[model samples]
Target chain A: MEVAAFYGFSALAILAALFILFSKNLIYGAFALLLAFLGIAALFVLAGADFLGVAQIMIYVGGILVLLMFGIMLTQRASQQDGPSRHNRVEVPITRRLWGFAIGIGIVGVLAKIIFSANFRMSGDAVSRKSTIKTIGVELMTSHLLPFEIAAILLLVALIGAAYLALNRNPAQ
Target chain B: MSAISIYHYLIVAAILFATGLAVAITKRHFVGILLGIELMLNAVNLNLVAFSRYDSDRLSGQLFALFVMVVAAAEVTVALAIVLRVYGHFKTVDPDKLDELKR
Candidate 1:
């Protein structure tokens, strides 16, 4: 069951990413990215990082994906002419091999085989699996307090900067 | 041996990262680049969370991944704002077409 779930979600992630790569339509690609994020979140859960998985769904799928879709829609061509040219096609020709992606997978596979077998675990040190929310909350309030504050500041700054940047439209107005 | 290991996770991450790289490289639109970057970041997070299993007690990896998620969120807001501003200025989002510095 664990193995099946692992491979299934893994495949979901990879395929969603590939769909985003191949799909020329920006809107469709963004939706595909949603799938990819979900798959990643599931993988996190399967790995026993329960809290992180839920956070992944809330943040990436909820916040970032929406922002991406907005970006795609806001920048669309308003020209009256209707044709394939206006369908949000990317630079990739249909015949493109996606070799870079293939190469990346190949390289990582080779390295994993040669440099790191990643088979053995510290049997004695293996911790019992449990809900990570308490641990995460405790850590966030304790040792991670400083970085937590910093991240809050970063989000505030980003929010203000984005709002300010996007406020003004036509210079003539 | 367990049905799944760190090796499986690593392979998945690799494929994701590679696909992201390809997406970034092949896609001409600026937003496509952003999409690619997002994928690559997610791939890295997967790696971190997977290895984080080793330190499940400390949850060092998960915390790191959390920080990464925070950064990614901040990044996307700023990037999309910039993209919107650029679209307003250049009237096009194609990176290749926007060759000149000034209109």
Candidate 2:
């Protein structure tokens, strides 16, 4: 049962990622990313990182994906609106497409071979355990405190920078 | 049957990372590239979480994954804002056309 669930979610995530990469329409890709993120979150849960999985859903699916969709919708050219489906189509040069496939396949083959052959020492208690939310919270407040505070500050700075960069006021004015 | 190992998670992460690389390389849109980058970051997070779960006693991997998510969020925010700026200045977001910095 667990294995089946894992396969289901992983397949969903992988297929959605494929769509995100291969789809021509930007909006369609963005929508596909939603499913991909959800699948990853599920995988996180299956891996016993329950808190991180929820955080993934909240932060990624809730915040970042919305931001991406807005960016895609706003940046389209005027000429793009004349066509229905072609408006946000990706225009990859033929040479670049061939090169991308070659590099991608090569990396995947190498990495898969390495992964299949590598020996990983396993913790027997990893999967059967639950209540990871408490462990994560305790760790965040204790050993990970400094980095947690720093991440908060980093987020604030990024928020301010994003607002400044996206401002539309004319500098001459 | 044996239980799922770190190898399974690692394989998924590898596939995801490779796909992100492909998307980053082949896509013309700046936002598409950003999405690719997000995919790559998620793959790294998956590896971190998996290793933390399977190999370590502490929750260090999950902690690092949380940090990675925070960083990825910041990156996407700043990157999208820059993409918007690029569109405002050049009137187009095509990376190839925004070769003004080259010359």
Candidate 3:
């Protein structure tokens, strides 16, 4: 049963990702990315990282996706003559498209070969079924305290920097 | 009938990462590139979570993945603000059009 669920969610993620790659409409790609994020979150739960799964949803889906949508909407040109669908379309040259496609396929082939040949003889026990929130919380406060605090500082800097950058620096354009 | 193993998760991550790389490379718009980058970050986090499944003792993988998420969030916010600024100054978001760096 769990195996089936894993395959289902992984397939959902892969398919959604491919959809984003093929879709020319930026809005469509963003929406498909939302599906991909949900699928990954489900995989996190299936892999026994329950807390990570929840956080993934809240951060990636709730926070990041919304920010991306705003960026897309805010950056669009006001030229409505080309229709709504074409307004946000990305025109990639044929050669660049070929190169990107080849690179993507090559990387997938190399990584798959490496993964399949790896003799991963794990020394630890199999995945524990317990909720990871407690372990994560405890670790964040104890051994990983410094990095946790550093991440907090990093976020504060980002908030201030973004606000400052968005402000109008020059009055006369 | 074996269960879902690390290999399965790794394969999914590889595919997602590759697709994201392609998106980042081929997209001309700044926001489109950022979308691709977000996909790549998620793929890496998925891989980390899969490995952490085995090492349940310390969970260093999950901890690192959380930090990665935090960094990605910060990156996206700052990137969008920059994208907005560029669009305002240049009247175009295409990276190719902006040839003069100090115009």
**Model 1: which residue pairs collide?**
none
The most accurate candidate by TM-score is 3
lDDT of 1 by residue, B1-103 (tens): 3457777888788878878888887788889999999999999999898788877667888999999999999999999999999999989888878878676
Residues B4-99 of candidate 3: C-alpha lDDT, one tens digit per residue:
878999999999999999999888889889988999999999999988988787898999999999999999999999998998899898998999
**Local accuracy of candidate 2 as per-residue lDDT tens digits, A1-173:** 88999899999999999998889888898999899999999999888888899999999999999999999988988765765766888888999889989988899999999887877656455653756877778888998889999999999999999999999876876
Q: For each candidate, C-alpha RMSD in Å?
A: 2.7, 1.8, 1.7
- lDDT per residue for candidate 3 within A53-152, as digits (tens), equals 9999999999999999999999888875475467788788888889999999999999999999988998775657777888899999999999999999
TM-score of 2: 0.95
Highest-scoring model, lDDT: 3
Docking class of 2: medium
Question: Where is model 2 chain A poorest over a 10-residue stretch in terms of lDDT?
Answer: A121-130
Cα lDDT of model 2 by residue, B46-76, tens digit:
9998887853346788889999999999999
Ranking by TM-score: 3, 2, 1
Listed in order, each prediction's TM-score against the native is 0.90, 0.95, 0.96
Better TM-score candidate (1, 2): 2
Docking class of 3: medium
